[model samples]
Target chain A: MARILAVDDSAAMRQMVGITLTGAGHDVQQAADGAEALEIAERQKFDLVITDVNMPKMDGITLVRELRNRASYRYVPLLVLTTEATLERKQQGKAAGATGWLVKPFNPERLLATIAKVLG
Target chain B: MPSSARPFTGASELAGLAPVAQDASQLPPALPGFESFQRFWDRDNGCWMVKILPGEYYVSRSEEAISTVLGSCISACVRDPTRGIGGMNHFMLPQDATQGPNDWLDPAIGLATRYGSYAMENLINDLLKLGAVRERLEIKLFGGGRILAAMTDVGGRNIEFIRNYMTLEGYRVAAEDLGGTQPRKVVYFPASGRARLRKLRPVENRIISHHEQLYLDSLGKQAAGGEVELFD
Candidate 1:
């Protein structure tokens, strides 16, 4: 089981992601936005980070760049999950060191499969 | 496996969201890819209004009211009264005819709860992003009328699910008008936190029940699973 950090402004999204990952036998922690997520990451290490792009305080792209700047999370996998599917946004996330971009309305099974693929 | 066979998941709520209304030229441009919603100026209420159908929710920081007609479905009117940011959602428990009516405690019922959680969470999340304080949120519950007598008491189940959700989430409900045999027309002004609701007679308005039933049926028919590539 991998330790994952899930960040989103919606409590429901966080809850759903938490439940899905937990059910798949992974340990998951949650935060409501990029700033809070950064705070959590400062305290401990995680195998993966799944975050929504649009958020308050700090967005997922900025968080990705910030995490990349740190030594511990330099090579950790960061996935951007959001409703914005524009090519420009994807390029921005990619430039910020995001490993993957999964649009919103994600399937739990697909999400799990992606996690397995990445962790392998 | 065919994607169509997958059951509806909470994330399905994120699909096809768009601005609502016919006079697209009159109102502000539709929010990006959201083309399925309806928004218009309400001369009656003297404000702009957005009407959301089932499986949709709307949030606003501007001075506009959101409206919807409900039968067996539920609409949770949530807002941070201090921030003048609020929204409404219209959703129902995805019905599987195979599951018996008495299976309220069945583990399968988690599907319903998850769907409800998504609806509630999305609205509240947007409000928070708009600077609405979670602690200062005042919620008003409406709809969930038992208009569908032939089917299971979906309305009652919705009420139970929403009530349990609010309690667990630690959000206080300011007022609620729920669970009866009649449909309702609810107009909620998120800016002022004022809700105007009117009960519509069951006999004359079969459309409410028909529309809600169709929505529930569609949810069951749609496949909620899909594949996505994870670019390295």
Candidate 2:
């Protein structure tokens, strides 16, 4: 089982992501926005980091950049999980060092499928 | 910048039996449901239409029906008892900010409407053109459910935005059914200024939220800002 860090400004979206990942046997940690996620990341290590794009204090794109700056997170799968699906936005995520991108409103099956692909 | 784009979009009229056509209708190149408007139809209601978020609304005098599904989103039905003109709007915080809604009021009236202020103005302006008087306007607010147990105060902020807007405008709210853990299905009858709200079950809420989130995700900054849900 992998340890995952799920972050979103939305409590509901965060809860859904946590439940889906945990049900799949992965341990999940959550944060409300990128700033909080960054603080969490500074101390703990996780197999994957999932985040939404738009949020207060800090956004997902910037968070990806910051996470990538850390040598320890160089190989961790940093996924951009958001409702924003534009190619430009996706490209931005990649430029920020995101490992993969998943659109929001994700379900258990689709989320798991994507996670499997990312982990592999 | 305070923006002026509308959040709720689509040709004001739905398919099945079209309402009196109007100018600048948005349904073109016709996205699946956009081609005909009527995604769902109910026989007894004359013809029924639905609104997606950030705010799609309509005013009707026929025996027609207007509806919307909510997930921490909001729907406001404004009617004129005197002129018998009314409409409903469904909107949420612009794109992903969900910040202090009132903070946007000063910048652009258009941007604020994507939240509540502009929705009220847009619907009220239409109602007035249809002969509705502010004093005779009846306002009813619905939705703002806590479907996302992990989210911040989005639902509460939406409620606060409208309330603050209405109060600032000196409009006495007729009624409201806000807050809770369930998303809502709201129906409004324009001719009679009557409305009905159903708290959707958890199963249905998840399905709808998933779809709406996809809709939100597919949006660009200006449009997705939830600024002009018409940006939808």
In terms of TM-score, the best-performing candidate is 1
> Best candidate per DockQ, number?
1
B117-157 per-residue lDDT for model 1 (tens digits): 65676677667767887789899999888886675787998
* CAPRI tier of model 1: incorrect
Residue-level lDDT of model 2, residues B66-90, one tens digit each, is: 7888888788888887776677887
Ten residues in sequence with the least summed lDDT for candidate 1 chain B? B100-109
Q: How well does model 2 score by local distance difference test? A: 0.66
Q: Which ten residues in a row have the lowest lDDT in candidate 2 chain B?
A: B223-232
RMSD of each: 11.7, 16.9
Per-residue lDDT for B173 in model 2?
78
- Give residue B155's error in model 2 in angstroms: 1.1
For A1-120, candidate 1 gives per-residue lDDT tens digits of: 999999987665676678789988999999988999999999999999999887878989999999989999998999987766678988999999998887655446667878898888
Off by over 4 Å in 2: A1-120, B1-36, B39-41, B44-54, B95-115, B218-220, B223-232
